[model samples]
Target chain A: MMHQKMTAITALEHSVEIKAVSKTFGSFHAVNNVSLPIRTGEFVTLLGPSGCGKTTLLNMVAGFIDPSAGAIHIGGVDVTDVPVHLRDTGMVFQSYALFPHMNVFDNVAFGLRQRKFSKSEVTHKVMQTIEMMKLSGMEGRRISQLSGGQQQRVALARAIAIQPKVLLLDEPLSALDKSLRAQMQVELIEMHRNTGLTTIFVTHDQGEALSLSDRIVVMNRGQIQQVAEPIDLYRNPANGFVASFIGEINALPAAIYQASDREISLAIGNIRMTAPRRAEWQFGQGEMVQAFVRPEHIRIATSADAGCNVVTGEVLTHIYQGSHTITRLRVDGLGPIEMRLPGGDVVGRVPVGMPTQIAFDLSQVILLADKSS
Target chain B: MTRQRPFFVQFLVPAVLVAVIFAAAMFNVLKYSFLEFVPGSLNVGGFTLENFTRINRPIYYWVLLDTFILSFATAFFALLLSYPISFALVRAERNWVRSVLVVLAITPLFTGEIVRTYSWMLVLGSDGVVNTALKSLGIIDRSVPIMYTRVGVVIALVQFAMPVMIILLATAISQINRDCEKAAANLGATPNTVFWWVTIPLTLPGILSGFVVVFAWTMSAFSTPQLIGGGKVLMISNVVYLQGFSSFNLPFAAVLSLVALVAALGSLALMKLLTARLEQNMATS
Candidate 1:
């Protein structure tokens, strides 16, 4: 029985393919030649800052806006001109966009009514969905009467009640408090697991995107810079934008010296290191390149460690986070390189203006592109 | 009413004074309605239903019905005209177009209804501009007589009624949360369905009052029917005027005015009932 159900689910096969899509508002381009393939039942997040056209791309997929060039296909069928109502794609807007004129039950039942379902079937399904959303007896309550969390649940129930082929979320948890947002994120993940719906979420919050998405599509200036799984995206960013966008990075400009089959060289502040390159970093020898190492990857020590990428500097400031210490070190030519260490575990008990030595793994660092205008 | 320091009255005192004046004014009308009319004098001492019975004739009844029919038709036509204007004013993307429409809506309201009616007379009369244009266009062989007909009165009433409906409907449509329309569309409702189901239902309260106001105004209208009908269309207001001033039947005129008041009040009550039920469900939803 489980095998049959798995096969049936596999037969559902509705992969979304976006082909060279671009959207322009008059003379200004909002999305530029972006292509992506979202596999069935895979949750993909289009992550970027405001005005990055992540929302525009999601809107095009929802059929709210037509792409200026190229096409969008759902399950291999082009639905470029299809209106929003015919697309059968569920969207959870940042504002929730729940019907203020409808109760929870009526809000959930709206799509069913549009399909002209029998009254009993609509009532039964609405009841079940409302319960599944943990809003049972509150079905008769007005939207304004419910709390923000309950209202969000009602909005989720409304969107998922129809069981559309794809679920689209546009910063749906933005209105919630931090604690509630974290809780709702867990609920959303559980919901995705239960339904196995292909979901595309657009968010400016990197943490939200990284935590929720199986794969993250990082965008900058309406162009996709990187698309990979959460771990791969965080560990191996493709460019300077992705490196700086994902997490805090201590980057310094360095000239490549020894470019070879398995290794490359970068010079930073009278210090040179032979960094291993799994593949060619696309730069010849004697070329300027930027190396980025995250704060957590750098180890601060009082004693010099040989055979490691070591840099000696003075501690500018030591910020005590709850369980960690972020020590800001001032090195020659490099203004500041931060080293985040476990609380009270950093050697020599970091003090402001005290001399310190920091060492990091060259293998863990990445070369980034220069984005100066 | 004084607003000066130390010359100000308390809110409750002024409110009581206003209520007392209202009661006295209504009592005076009631007393005048009860006064029986004799040959040379009104018998103020007598109590009788003779005036009410006098207005029960088929001629008066038909004229009263005509007034009611005219009121309903004018209100309906005004509502129909106002809906699209209100929708545009509330939904149009361009501010200039909305502002222009608003100015157009306000221009009609600022003009007195009599002036508007006179303007219509110039347009709709036999030798008026509209008839001349129609004749020139070969749509009609001769001047079309319209100034003294029900159509003329209806046209005048509609002209007067539309601005009120537009203002009220625009205010009502503004109060509707736009999210409801988006929600309707998201739920697979077509644009037309969203408009009819969500937009219209939400704005019904606003348009409902617009209808009642226009209906009451049209029912009590004296100048429009008098000027446009040219003493031909005998609406109830005309009948009341004839009884009170021309025919010297004060009692019958009072009875007719009372009937007019009752009709207006009844229609308002019906409007209230219809909208109240709809709003109750809407509130819960």
Candidate 2:
């Protein structure tokens, strides 16, 4: 399997290959021994909470930080020891780090000028990038004169103006307001599509990771948990961390699992539920397993419900979101279980301290091996 | 409801008292500059502009020119030496390194001006530490005459002005967003290029203020030039002292003092104008 995977990695035209890269500060491992190969023109995101080594990994790729062990290959060249200036990676800093002394044109022209481009070529490229970033007439304006979103665009323009081999974005949209953040996300997508540059973005926001990345590398505790496409990652997380980190889900208590060719049965507390057997169900018949169910999959039980999947609980709280209401219920043995219903109608129907029955949509459940056992 | 205010007026009382006394002393100096100095007498005659006219002579012109040149050189050299120390003080990765640099940079300020000037004399004198070291190293066979020279005066003055320059520069450098430098490097600027293109321009305000402050401070320098220059390199301050004490021409001394004061104020105004233009150019909202 390892040999096949290695051959597959070598067969593709990977733009960046991180080989067993690790960085340790004193005894704390910021990035453990990890390897990832990014294909050309791929938009990859390192998604994890703060201090989980996502930014550290991105910085190592950008040549801002060096790995204590292992090699980084960019464009088929070993650039592990290369200094940041020599590393042909364009980076947009989170603060937008636009030169306050220079106007938009000069700031965008800086990288081109460093490469010894001709005066007219620098002007042409800068103008083209500014136009692409929609910063057309603001070339003469100082960075401080531009609005926050405009400054962000200028930062992007400055980084991409050089047409680098790889573009690295370090949480570049995190500083904007909610509305502006949504706007910039669309612009970022458009920019990525237009440039087709192999980009690696680092962000702790799972929503951004899900929306922006071609492949999301979910990470935790200085190691990669899983790397998959957006829908596959959200639907089939490799572990409990990725499942809970990606979206809201309820982790039922450790349960006994019994599987057959046609169906898989799980016993949680005194409640029993049966799910249609998936081809990927590789657990032993009597193994201990944990079940994760998304809030949307579980709903209020109607009178027609007569199965063991139905559980009784008292409503704890109702959080009314604009399009949906998240109702929290304290189950007898399962602690708090959250169910997402469409609209605020659930708030008037289910008051606090009222007992109700919630049925799990068994087909949509996610089962992982209970490692604690 | 009426808001209860803090005692801001009470806080200004001591400062106002000091300003009043300072203004009275300055008024007395202005009055003396307009009076006539009776030769060899302690008293002054009716108001006249003779003292101002005496300032146009080549000898006094040389004194004023020397003072300006020395002060400018001191400020320039002090800025050069202080910049590296200040950068290290602010940017050192180790806390102890920053602490050591701060202590060394500021320890000179605690010493009295007379004491510091006397110490420089010992270092710059014939057969002094520098001369003896050079002679022993065979770099020079003869003891170089640094004492009573413009070089000696400037060297002493530059050292004297560095503590203030470092403090101002450290503050400016610490306030810089380091991400700017990192971004410059990420855009293919070498470390050297980053320093010149980003770091230096970002600290221009601090540089301007430090230069002006050192310039003004060095203009009124008295004991450093008096002791180190030893009457050979006469600055306006030393000339003011000579006229007041040796020549007993209080009016002439007051006129020189006024000129020094005006020169300092004029430099500060120029600095203000330059900084305003800079702030406008690099307008950080």
Best of the candidates, TM-score:
2
* Regions of candidate 1 where Cα sits further than 4 Å from its true position: A1-14, A118-124, A257-265, A270-277, A280-282, A302-332, A336-363, A371-373, B1-69, B89-106, B126-151, B171-183, B216-220, B230-285
- Name the regions of candidate 2 deviating beyond 4 angstroms: A1-12, B1-3
For residue B170, give model 2's deviation from the true position in Å.
Answer: 2.1
Candidate 1 CAPRI category:
acceptable
TM-score of each: 0.81, 0.95
Candidates in order: C-alpha RMSD to true structure = 5.1, 3.8
Candidate 1 lDDT, tens digit per residue, A266-334? 777678877787674688777777888899988854345664677778988777786988888888878
The TM-score of the first chain in every model comes to 0.92, 0.95
The candidate scoring highest on DockQ is 2
Instruction: Give the fraction of true interface contacts kept by model 2.
Output: 0.78
| Number of the top-ranking candidate, with lDDT as the measure | 2
Candidate 1 residue lDDT tens string, B42-79: 44447776777777689977998999899999999999
Candidate 2 chain B lDDT trough over 10 residues, lowest sum:
B1-10
Poorest stretch of ten by lDDT in candidate 1 chain A: A1-10
